[model samples]
Target: RVGLVEWEAERHLLMLDIHHIVTDGMSMSIFVEELLRLYNGETLEPLRIQYKEFAAWQQSEPVKERLKRQEAYWLDVLEGELPTLELPTDFVRPAARSFEGDVLPFSIDKQMTDSLQRIADENGATLYMVLLAAYSILLSKYSGQEDFIVGMPVSGRTHADLEPLIGMFVNTLAIRHYPSGEKAFLAYLNEVKETMLGAYDHQDYPFEELVKKLQAPRDQSRNPVFDVMFALETKEDNVQSFGDIKIESYPETHTVSQFDLTLVISLLDEGMNGQFEYATKLFTRNLIDNFAQDLLVIITQICEQPSVLLKDISLNGQSEQEQDVLEAIDIIF
Candidate 1:
């Protein structure tokens, strides 16, 4: 759905409301580039493979065999009872889940960001891996669940031909982790890096298909495997112009939450900025604020002492009551 609102003569707002079913984050970039080129009266070369052909190919026997091989990998890693996170919520969970949610924004200073990047570089990992390890620690602190899955989206454009097209090529990977507070942050980060690389290798497998294969007990109150998600956006393109027409991206006012909690971090020129989008029925602003603070504290501490044990990490001066609340989940160590 696209719209154009003309505020005044020579002043108009172009709006594009795309659904995830037909397009994805990477596709949006391609869409915008093509849109601008076409606006400037330039013709793009014809795409070799259209979306219809791609869809058909995905359903072909060869693709099915490949997915079957990937399926075995997922099944082996995810075998046995899956861990359900017991994160403390302000309100009782409803019989069924609700999408009502809100976002709490936060930022990490440039110095802290640089320190984290240095730690990542030293550990043979990317910044995303470092952040994922820290996030897993945070989840462990709150839920006291050592084994859980975190869902992340990967661009499914494995072929170069798919790069120039606009389509929904985003696939979610359920990254399972067993975070031990007794383990050093650096060690856990290395393990996370390995897991991330393996997931990337099998990124083409569809998440829904994996869910069907698992056939875990169906729960109306939550998602099949994971209720939490993590995403990192490094692309910073926001402002553009087309022949004297200035275009600017507007900040979104999100009213829906796809999961119980989602941490979205954006890498910007200024620093590392992000937001925690949480379901309102399960959390209050104060709790999410504490989460943000605790996450930052963990990141800062790990950057300072990469070998520090996760159990000894700080929680941004949380109150004794708050500490008790988190500790009450389950004392593993």
Candidate 2:
């Protein structure tokens, strides 16, 4: 048994404990709704197929051929000396990394969220693109590297049958973003949008299949290829109720960091809610909180003036690159 919840309300107010192994974000929602409906004595349609069938079919011949087309694209995207995010850890990492994690929650005000949405719409991009750009900007600033990779989870329900059934119908994809040219936040948004579009177009390739194909250099101290994950969750995760007993779900973060860190951002009526999951082995709450605040600042400023140089977004004044660029400009002038 991976997890259990003490249902004795006297001892423990309404709570849930589930192992990450059995369910993902999407699957948990399905499980809850189904349980409620079943308790209310409502008959439901029979499941077309279960997880076992889906797993078996994934290994079939035709699917393998289809996935081949994606191999070349993933390989090219991940090419070069793929380095991990250069986040400074508090201590030297052990030979084998631990999975302890912590979750820091924060919210972006409605005005900033709306501004970002407008920017996204104006640019023919989704809010995901806008948020991702801002996130990439933060990573860029922290690591001081124009190019790096971040993982994003995709609902692997490419087939219609897999949608209604509750299972691990999700896959994690690595997005390797390369900041181009003058590195204005606006242009970076466009770059991220394009990458997102490509990822969607090629979403059918199973993540494991892609990772196996890439053969990324392994580092036991961290995850292969990418060490950070970013997810943008939507309305599907809203609070559910069966007439008065409202049950709201919040992300559960712990002492382990899965792949250096995982950032989960959810869209809410008030604004965007962000949960930063970091490894306890490498960071503290204060540091993660500061990073989260900085991200909000970045998002706020970028939407207000998208054309601003990436260097200008720096919290500690101009970055080294910004100074170098200024020096060149001064010499030329």
Candidate 3:
């Protein structure tokens, strides 16, 4: 019955220690919600399956076969492709190792989210595709490369058996989008939808194994493959309470990873929330924040004027901070 408690710090940070056997990201959310109820003197329904059951189920035969086939697909599709995007840099790029940094988060409004969803539905695509396409375009503009690569995480739970059992089942799929001159939004959306569907169709492959199969040249100079990753997580079952104790989540500071950079955007009924986690050694917090703001502006502009030229779109509403960041990258590399 390890529960929440406060840590001593100038700023607020909540701490908790749940045995690894009992919790994961998904379960932690639920545990928090339960804690809240209990602290307010309420009870909760018992969980259907303990964590070990889920872990054991994940090792079953069907899961293995699915993973094998997915690996084959990834090996074939990703073969011979340059694993990394050549991002323009102002300084000499650092070694291949990932660095730690901070996360800058922000959100979109409900009206915008609704509009984006409606457009996605009408276009016979998904909100995810729309976001991916926009990100591709942005990468192309920033890198001066027409073909852009981005890594996205998929739930990778195609079968009913795997849905209830979660153990790092998320697969990172590499999407390569090559934008042609003056392509229409619907056309781009169609391409993105197809790419996403194909990736989903073969997403059981573990990302680490796929990278090995691709023989992606390890570059101590930069990230091995893609420079950016996008993740969308919308659901969390969280409750917090314990006896007469109430619990609330204070913001937590996240250490950045070694990967080039990752922008995780989540959509809720209310709006969209974005978190930019980058290598502190590679980029300053201000640079990452500017990129997030610029991305929001780009998405908004595309929603209003999807037909705008790619170059024009990238250069739109360029703030001094963003320009400086871009220029710095350009000068460094």
Residue-wise C-alpha lDDT for candidate 1, range 37-122, written one tens digit per residue:
89889899999989988999999999999988999889888999988988999999988989999999999888988998999998
Please list all clashing residue pairs in model 2, or write none if there are none.
99-256, 100-255, 100-256, 100-257, 101-254, 101-255, 101-256
lDDT, model 1: 0.88
Residue-wise C-alpha lDDT for candidate 3, range 1-333, written one tens digit per residue: 444344654333456765654444554555556556765777665656654765676588997888788777776666666735665543456654657667888887887777778778988888888887877766665666777678887765566554444344455788777865467666777888998888888776667777777786676766656778887778432334456454455555688564667877876657888887777767777766667777778788778876665545654576335677899999999
Query: Residue 60 in model 1: shift from native, Å?
Result: 2.8
Candidate 3 TM-score over all chains jointly: 0.77
True-vs-predicted CA distance for residue 126, candidate 3, Å: 1.8
lDDT of each: 0.88, 0.79, 0.69
lDDT pick, better of 1 and 3: 1
Candidate 2 C-alpha RMSD relative to the actual structure: 3.9
Which of the predicted structures, 1 or 3, would earn the higher TM-score when compared with the native? 1
Name the lDDT value of residue 76 in candidate 3. 69
Candidate 2: where is the Cα deviation over 4 Å? 1-22, 235-239, 244-253, 316-333
